[model samples]
Target: MSSAAPVPGRFTFVLHSHLPWLAHHGRWPVGEEWLYQSWAASYLPVAEVLRTLAAEGRTDLLSLGITPVLAAQLDDPHCLSGMHHWLGNWQLRADEAAASGNVALGRHEHRLAAHALADFEQRWRHGGSPVWRELIDGGAIELLGGPLAHPFQPLLDPRLREYQLREGLADAQHRWGHTPAGIWAPECGFTPGMETGYAAAGVTHFMVDGPALRGDTTLGRPVWDSDVVAFGRDLHVSYRVWSPKSGYPGQGAYRDFHHYDHATGLKPSRVTGKNVAGPDKAPYDPELAAAAVRRDVADFVATVRQRLIDEHDRTGRPALVVAAFDTELFGHWWHEGPQWLEQVLRELPKAGITVGTLEGARADGYVGEPVELADSSWGSGKDWRVWAGDQVQDLVTLNAEVVQLALDTLDKLPRGGERDRAADQLLREAVLTVSSDWAFMVSKDSAAGYARDRAHQHAHAVREIAAALGTGSVAKARELAAGWCLADGLFPALDARRLRRCRDEHTSTVPTGHTSAVPS
Candidate 1:
């Protein structure tokens, strides 16, 4: 008897690459190390995996979100040079290891170190690897764009929100050679009215966590008031790969993320035999870890395949399993992540799974019904507590105060050249005030001091501009603008006249709680 062929369903993966604007800034806790580590462990290695897949003609459908701020830093001359130097240093470290007595460590080190250096030089030496272009060109990956600096959308003043979205899209177009159809809303921070902004900017779809779908984690669907589609991450399939407690990385064979030697500053052992400390760790062996990677990839593929089969059986439609993750989690946190990714992509296709991007899935009619979305983000508790928590409460309050001040000042300015300049500065200040990085840093407790400093710096700029306008100090206003120009160098497309017009048109209709002083 002949057997029936297995039906294919949609399986999509979205990787969001984000790092704050950290160029020419270095101070340990939250500085240049963040960029270097991600480059070494994540970007360069991940690029290689995607490139390998494309070369094999197995360009699996994947969506990648590289935030504009991260793009700028990646393309910066200083960052490129620093990465080159770091890659060379890694080669030297590998050579030293090879000369040591440890044969297994030496073998793996020599191979990976050489591979990483060659990959970095060939792909990312100048500006950035054309990896993004190659992926898009080869149909291996779809690029999802985001705001210029990855600011939280809901908390930002509405006037500045448009500027952030517009400039962010413009930057992506300038760098990547095309405007994106989708966005990874910085931190998945979505609000009801933000849809109008996305619609105006031409973003047809964006992502949110599974919980944001009113607990219905299915395919992409439109929001209530707007035509734009929203896709929710499938937490069920995703957590299996990397959950807080039960992830593959926490397995005994994986390299320990927390216990790198401070003196050598390199990870020298695996988390072999759970509860064992780093100093007492077993010898490092890539072969053992590769076995673990194979097992994890199998688990992930089975999870995806089974989920799709179940959903297809239930709905009688090709169901989608959308898996989302931070790009850093691969190389930076889970050393075998790049390996696992390669294996998963290769194995899934052979298993009768149709790997696809968000856009392709939507185009194939994988959309569902619309619903009203509540305030949500993909943080620790799947809420806004990260941004509005006690750690950064003071900065949050200060941000609110300065935003209100800027709005108030814009309200009083006369419609002339001076008013125009003031409006531009007010918009700049307002957007910078709502950057999610500050609150995130504080909440993670990685660099609370730096976060507080950035918040205050932007707040000071807003206050200075407001003070200059209040006293009619045009010279001081120019000085403050020049000073603030150091950090808040975004929104070159911002037109003060439009803001002035918005203020003039909306003054009478301003809501009681809304800040109308700043033009939207």
Candidate 2:
């Protein structure tokens, strides 16, 4: 075979790993189960893939974003125990399916479940910090962090935004001994002038959607004259793997993510045909799916190659192609996803394409001219509608009211003696209330009831604690705050005292005409 010429640009795959705080929350349909499933199906395998690559001496392979709230859950004692149990149960369930005569499905699941169980027992028992830190230390991946609780920063109070981001960076340092210079901004949400806040927080780079850069995504751009850079996701490249209309995961040969064997709690069917009903779909054939993964891997490699060549021809320089997605989209949502990811990574180099992390991209000079980026998100309409839409008006109002109350109450409380559990818990509830997941779920109608209930629960906690303090029921306030802490405890480094009025507050305002406010 002839040796192919080198590809003209670099490629970065970013995976944003996040889930709303779910400890002590209900299970089954939507709660701790969400966490456990993603942990087993996505995190375990994905990290293993990275470890395998690192052993081969690969470095700067990708950018991995783990939000503070998710990190907290991963390292939480309660979550660790729960995950252990979940892995064992998964193995047991697979065995049950085998005993019930679905031999193929049973064997498939059993092998997977057993591997997951052993992986969890040996590597993950201590918690996620060490698992992730290993990758960071190996220089296999760059860790990206976001604000506490993954709140939608654009809709949040400026002071609260600043506080959350600072504490988030500190939390990363506390966990992995390194503060990330880049972030996968929650929801990729941004309002104008947020870059200045990012600069103040010492962030050097962040990601946004393709449209946020007006389709010019060949390189990272400095935002509004700040030293901070904004890397725009290349939709053309990203959508090849997963998009609204078509994607590799939807291929008929791949396992059906939605079709489940209820008794075994395992998916048993393949896509077979898009119109095929669950029961009518063919049984999942690993061999067939593996073949599809190979085909799709070739397709994606070719797609990236052409895109890079086209970009180089246009820009007269080596370009950057970024394809980012939620980490859970791997084994959790697409059974063949991990397989596809591994093959793609291995094949890219042989195919003459270069792979590197976002940090490496910036450091290697893959940056472009400065631009004044406006309000944008990777959400619906490429704006903040998913978080601040009319459909979530009540939630928007609720977040506003609760956050103001929490701030005012914290402001009145004494500052800087020690970490006040009551004040910390109050702020925790407030932060949880504004998580972008709640509104996104509500807008997408994925789990609207659960989303609304969670938002209200956190809002209620904030109100009760503040009211107790106002009524001089100091004991009552502590009790209420302590109770909420049982569930909303994630960021231990958060200091409510620091959230008090700042003499020079970092406002997120960016002058007139730049307001990308959600439609009223």
Candidate 3:
């Protein structure tokens, strides 16, 4: 080790990037538009920031988790063409706004659209794999991955959970040629003994909520005597920028996410006040937002500095503070987020606050004593309620039923024969049915109808294909499965033959834990 003095604490940012499979889905209010918006507003700019920083010799800037489902879309031939068209449409909309006399909004959007188009053409034309590969191979960031469809691990059937986790890791390996050791567990939802499953899948580390650690998030903690560690997000520092009630994005100078100019399809107003109506919002001023970004960056650096000193003083040891957020928060939900991120990454080091990735934190000994973790998530109430609550009980039940049928049908399929397209599609539909997003959206009432519709459609596909296979109508089953695969064909790597109900792999035998009403 170098003879340099240890800093008070280290800080790392974890950005979870994910979206349910949306290829060939409907376009507006909830479907492919979600993918295109995030790709344009978040992925394009975020990749640019990392690329710029990496060119300047930066490494280990942050840990980014791109769920397997989302990765598949980003690289899919269909989605790439869709994104390209989306960019072109964006420029056209800007031109329309200008011709219609909304000059300021038009000028702003035109510049952004032009830049995004250039970036897409230059770096992303082939697919997201190359874009992500450059960052991973260059050591610019640590890529964290999760299950095939971001299922809620706690409620997922053990066999399905194991299959998804293992397949998810393999998906990452296939995409980037490096299997991630860490995962941003879907919903940050976890149950006890999952560490055993994680270990079996070669995952060395994963993330949970702050309260899961009983609020002692000084470092990563090993779970249940295993080498696998769980890192709890330090909510004190994390919430300062991500809290739903108040965060940097909520500042009045920032652009308002809810208000949009219908003609040009652009957000042209600043958050004038917390309770102000959309029409009352003031026109957005980039200069003012830039100032706010600078102020917030300084404030964040100061926050991290104070946190480091306070932690060091309290523990008599250097500390680690992990601030995790959704990657889409940058430039997507918060228009100024990418700028804020760039400034914060640059300012933290200048302020003598160490910035590193989660992988680096683990290797640098930012770990704590072993602790028995429980059922928890970084969601409403910091428990499983967001995914398994009363509002989503139907979805919860549906997921269980679909998973069982898919597993049973796959198990009964003959071994070592031509690949059964029906079986693969059944598993695919089953996995899609259990995606945490459906339940989350339902529970939160964000497009609950859409969530329910999606859940049921997938479940129906599972039931249809399973029935056809059960009745010895092999051709009929394949036909049904082929029809479903037209829409949900993201993971070509998923072969039903590779799946089995292995029950003895996980070493930890602790019973599943219960959830509390603790708020995250």
Which candidate number maximizes TM-score?
A: 2
Can you write out model 1's per-residue Cα lDDT over 254-279, one digit (the tens) per residue? Answer: 98887764543567799886779778
TM-score of each: 0.88, 0.97, 0.96
Q: What overall lDDT goes with each candidate model?
A: 0.77, 0.90, 0.89
TM-score of structure candidate 2? 0.97
Model 2, stretches more than 4 Å misplaced? 1-3, 501-517
Report the C-alpha displacement of residue 330, candidate 2, in angstroms: 1.0
Q: Once model 3 is optimally superposed onto the true structure by TM-score, how far is the C-alpha of residue 144 displaced, in angstroms?
A: 0.6
Candidate number with the higher TM-score (2 or 3):
2
Residue pairs that clash (backbone atoms under 3 angstroms), model 1:
407-517, 407-518
Q: Give the clashing pairs for model 2.
A: none
Candidate 2 residue-wise lDDT, 1-520, digit = tens:
5536898889999999999999898897999999999999999999999999999999988999999999999999999999999988988899899899999989999999989999998999999999999999999999999898898888788888888999999999999999999999999988877999999999999999999999999999999979899999999999999998889899999999998899988898999998899999999999999989999999999999999999999999999999999999999898889988998898888888999999999999999999888899999889878887889989988888888788778777765677777888898899999898999999999989999999999999999999998888889999998888877777877778778746147443312353455665
Residue 320 alpha-carbon offset, candidate 2, angstroms: 0.7
Misplaced by over 4 Å in model 3 are 1-6, 501-520
